[model samples]
Target: MPRSLKNPKKAKRKNKGGAKKGEASSSSSNGIPSIPAKVWQPGVDALEEGEELQCDPSAYNSLHAFHIGWPCLSFDIVRDSLGFVRTEFPHTTYCVTGTQANSAAANSIGIFKISNISGKRRELVPTKTSNADTDMDSESSDSDDDEEAVNDGPKAPVFQVRKVFHQGCVNRIRAMTQRPHICATWGDTGHVQIWDFSSHLNALAESETNISKDATTVSNQTPLVKFTGHKDEGYAIDWSPLVPGRLVSGDCMNAIHLWEPASDSTWNVDNKPFVGHTKSVEDLQWSPTEQSVFASSSVDKTIAIWDTRLGKSPATSIKAHDADVNVISWNRLASPMFASGSDDGTFSVRDLRMLKEGDAVVAHFTYHKRAITSIEWSPHEASTLAVSSDDHQLTIWDLSLERDEEEEAEFKAKTQEEVHAPTDLPPQLLFVHQGQKDLKELHWHTQIPGMLISTAADGFNILMPSNIESNLPANTAAA
Candidate 1:
């Protein structure tokens, strides 16, 4: 009754290429070439129909997706004092931010407001298979039919454009946390401009017409304050989260300036700029708990923490990485705790309380295969963080988990086995986001608990945790 006896099959001989005798022959029987069918190789465990795969890092369930046609270099989420979360994207026709006339003429920032509607929900339907017919007449008819079908389907999520701000390709935008109506932007012109949108918002509330039809131009409206101190294009800017009307900006010339608003609608820049880094300052972030404390990362492969009250010299300086440091974020809940992401595809968390001259990092994460472009800590959760990499992935990590000794040992062994394999997802990882191409920016929604907004070269996405449902209304506009 043995299974081998029942089959009674002869052992198959292998070919020179190691293929079985009958599986893939060297030649065809009809004098034609034999093309071997691709064999499916299982890289991980297979899943059954309707079953979900449980991994160490939980996956993000997409809630809303939007395509904005133009590539986005940077973006920010503005939460007004009224607790309304608005998304903004700076779109440019050019890939580089240059001072040429063409770059200025093609730059515009898109501002969108997300509102929840009642009794309406939109679901993603699978894309339909195209017809095999290649006839021009048939293709034309099919295209027309497809358009008609889409128009007849349920409404899509509505992203109402509140307004558009026309300017040179803005490299960075930071909305003041204390004064939500005020925002600061800088780009190729080496000038920092502060804009107040209170009047624009008021006009929109009073008018029933679409604001995009009569968009405002930056040239027409006067900025609240403008400062031109950088000798070259400014790429980094940040408004103090705890202080009103205080800002700091960094330029390509390796210069950092602090600005404070004056009474005559002008900004007063520090006579002397912070000047320790030998390379360009990549990012700047003010401490959430300390108003006068801030940190800056640079292409010099170092991170320096500065106290605004002090002149020139950074209070604390550390050689953070072997490569350029691209982004730094302060932990909102824990004072003295911050994280830095570098061009070497690694990020580390450090505690300022224990930082010394050498090896101040508390933990190192090397999961991203490409340079880290942006990093942010959750405002609501103490240990949660989000990072975007050039590899086109947005990952969320929960740093609260404590791994056992055995798991730690196995993780180290696997890390050496596969140098290029994604860094082992510590139990701390919560989600890995995909679908967006050339992802550049990510931020947590201030009002929504588990909502995240991301902008990439092709489009933007509004992501939600797997357990949460979509908050969009059913009657919203479709993409």
Candidate 2:
């Protein structure tokens, strides 16, 4: 008998919505998907029961027990159930797994075929597929209009992801201001590899031609361009959301290179890496509501906002943190406002127009017991931000309407637990990439507004929308 059938009955619905105490939720509406309950127990035990138990078949979310090494990551993407059953789209899904120290894995990039997205553990396909199949087009008529997502609580995704890129111990992944294209993945290797997701689609097309004899030739949209002008790894790269194809990349060399990606023939260096920070640059973000204006933070304990059209001097500077600035995010809901986290085990948000020091911060987001790695704003929602850190935790912040701060106590950062509540709108989130090991990078599926792909410190994960009802699932509305 097959393992899936051994204890075949669907595990009792612990709760159709939230996880038990000390238990984590699996899906991600923001960029960092939380660890699944199924994988968490074994992991805790692994820390106690030893490595073998961590590798046991029971570790898989499914009875069939597909084991993703202990240090893996999962991303949540979106999909079209009807199209998937008809095989219209790639239904591309993935999970990034890592190699233990001294393990023989070569730090690879991977994509998995996911037919279902209803649980924490995902089923993998035998053969590889292209990484295209997303909803990049600002306009589209080809979608499952009747398809609905399952647990579309705040921030859940309702699309699909096709491809991913991974390198070991990633430094950061950032979305460019450019339209439907441009994302950067960097590390300490002195090499900042900017993945042109548009190109991933073409790679998929080329691979498709070699596989099925009847497969039709599809479009091959490559990443607009890739760059390697730095002599060292660019610690930070940001796209001028105001101008498509324009990028600014920086490295430990203390130099910022402006890139014209379309032609790749020109680059301009800021007078002196936007001097005045007086230390190494750590993180950056383009003002969500402003064009050509962006913010940068550094170990010098300050934050600087710049306008590329203006001279090399920072437009405004603030000694925002007591330690190295780790992550920065411009609030999308409020103008002239942004947030920063530091090594001091604290985080703060500032208003560009204000000169007050710590007095300028709107929310003091601190729950991660450690340094925050990054803070990403929701492209679709204002004030809603996602934070990830070395503390092995992901926290979501909503400044609009507090859900009664009186509710839950164990749910850090957030005053309460959502219990995987339901939503009236379709999930607009793309990928929620929570790494199995230390998280390195995350990417959103282009073309598909609500899909995502992620590369971890280990491998890669392609997330699809399982909360969305599937046409193939016998009990789905589409069925």
Candidate 3:
């Protein structure tokens, strides 16, 4: 089951079994008092010696947790042809993950086809004083029999996985945006290998429970191309979204290699490497619109903008953070905007146009107390992004939000007794998700409007928080 998160306005209480004074608790049809939901701020809230956190099923639209045999340090959501802009219930998704095994020979890459994701869809109820539209008259006329027919309990989610034996402990794995089955892997052996998992993907999409076990056999698993050009092992790699088959891989030795498609199953990597960063390139992202333009973040504490046509040097570079930069995400919807996270737990959003003119960054936050592990912009929302840190928290942010004094005063007056939150928290911080241990990577499902998948040492969590609003049809029923 997926863990629950408290609403931001809800007070953090040690004992949530009973509602406090001034809070109203309603009884169910069986006359049992309902427990009010509460937020538990990590580090700030302490649990009783015998008490532990528990999942609140009502707080989520959908939540599921599962683990593979081994822990995955890095993973990418593999794009599938199931559907686009999927907003209905019972969602399915595909992804590729690289595992860190006890021995190099035991490591493998996993391609999973997870399905039957079912859950209650939430509907926002408007307050009496709110100016939102209403349909109480029409809703009252609806027959109770019609509602009962739609109330079947959610079904358990199912998954089918295909394993491919890797030569070494896979440091990172990424599926091509244009060709998801053709993935690239950065191995600890200081080599980058391209794999064609089309056969495995085809089998998973076509079959139900009878997927071929031979797909996991070592003899049948082999890379389409293995380039042993980088002097040292690294994790930085990305495929161009604008150009199919174009790739860039950066190494710990401060070298970046460019790969161009020589044929369907092969790539020709340039002998000379891009040499701008003085330290390890921590992450790389190709421009969403421009084929040759890309951005890189490094341990040198700087962000460099490079254009392949311009040469080996960076076209523009800036001291982005005070510490080593760890990851970056180029916004696909907003081409000029990008976000970067650093080793110091701070993440900032930047505008490429402003950077070129030497203007200040758009927004910066230091909310995470530990180093940031992964950060990515939502594929569907231009102003929204998700971030994960070593502190074992994943936070969702909407860049467009700002402190509204009038709204804040109204909200405080309306729910003064039931609501509480630190004044120091940024208004842009929309939601905070916890319960995962040693969070390493997170990705928003491009097909599902508000779905998210996060991988940690504890395993994987697939959740869709009810609080995060999305662009869904107005007639959709709420749970």
Candidate 4:
């Protein structure tokens, strides 16, 4: 059976409204036909009258969305000391996001502590087609509509947030693995600022209310270290996982700077920048196991592997994509495997061992129809990945999946209905989550298995799909 099928008896619900019957006989109040598309694409398919996206409660382990007043261009999941490998529900997680406010003075770094993420798991009623299928369709529609109406209102999770005044629009934000309160921000003013928000985090933890106004006013909002060495602003930055406090920042001018810890809270960024890519460096990822090694994607349509001890040049470079490579995610569990997303709405996985033998790319996919915005590998599942694109879709994929003809045939026979999917849709495609507008970036919670937090123009979405399995035992719970 495919990884997408959690239970053979309960098939995945593709569309909320019953599949289109035929040409519409009459229009509905919403100025659309009464029928909804079988498979809706964001830009391609239009919704029929009275057609709205209805969430299947059974399809989600936990789903919640919230807004922070401003749209963040980038955000990172702050690893908390709240025990690793969390499996139980009502999880708590910390995060930091940089805002692209209308005015530079209005921009601030937002730190959030979200909790009580209870599951929305429900058992779906099996649909039975009888009386020429029309009677069954109406019954299904009424049942789903009632469920959606009950869940339509905002179900905001408990959260505490703090704001630190930033000098300019924050292009990207990253939190250190060992010390999550220590965060790095790439500002539009061409400066990278390192801040220690230990006070803010401490106050938040102590606070009892959902909003932490005391914590918001407590921090000095001063960066421990500020480096203006980069001539131009950039979005690419990453902290080395192997070495604590080791950081790297890449710029639009094709310059990458390495930062070493000078003291406990300060960094000594090398004046000399690492030069290799001809165009802007789009993203950076440090090797999870190798202390001195890292990888970079660039607007030059290539991916380069670099080492800090190997001078200013890249160790190896590959023409990894047809268009500008926007993002890259190095697999933490499987160090040899990494993935890259491009401007042309495509992403591919590569293996370092195969790259040395001239066969770098292991699996390439083009399911997204717009520019790939962000991509990341699951910390728990080495073969699993999550990608966001300009197409307004956040897709989760399991690369371990392959087409199973026998399973498909058996599923159709047992369910009495074929699963609705395009012929070209890969079996590896596990889930497609929509509804967020202009999705910017996404990250998997390192401590919480199957949990994903994404930011976009609208706000933030914290979700864990029901179908994705976690290896962590149920006894382990979040602190």
How far does residue 171 in candidate 2 sit from its true spot (Å)?
3.8
lDDT of 3 by residue, 83-119 (tens): 7677776678889987776777777888887777666
Q: Quick one: ranking by lDDT, best first?
A: 4, 3, 1, 2
Q: Return the TM-score for each candidate structure.
A: 0.69, 0.55, 0.83, 0.85
lDDT of 2 by residue, 214-240 (tens): 122322333333455565654566766
Q: For residue 31, give model 2's deviation from the true position in Å.
A: 41
lDDT of 4 by residue, 162-230 (tens): 888988788899999988889999998999999998887887777656763233452346799999999
The candidate that achieves the highest TM-score relative to the unseen native structure: 4
Number of the top lDDT candidate: 4
Q: Could you tell me the C-alpha RMSD of candidate 3 in Å?
A: 8.8
In the order shown, the candidates' Cα RMSDs to the true structure are 14.8, 13.8, 8.8, 8.3
**Lowest summed lDDT window (length 10), candidate 1:** 133-142
Per-candidate local distance difference test: 0.59, 0.42, 0.75, 0.76
Go through the candidates in order and give the clash count of each. 5, 32, 0, 1
lDDT of 1 by residue, 44-115 (tens): 323334322211111222234443324556767766433342222111110111111134655555554433
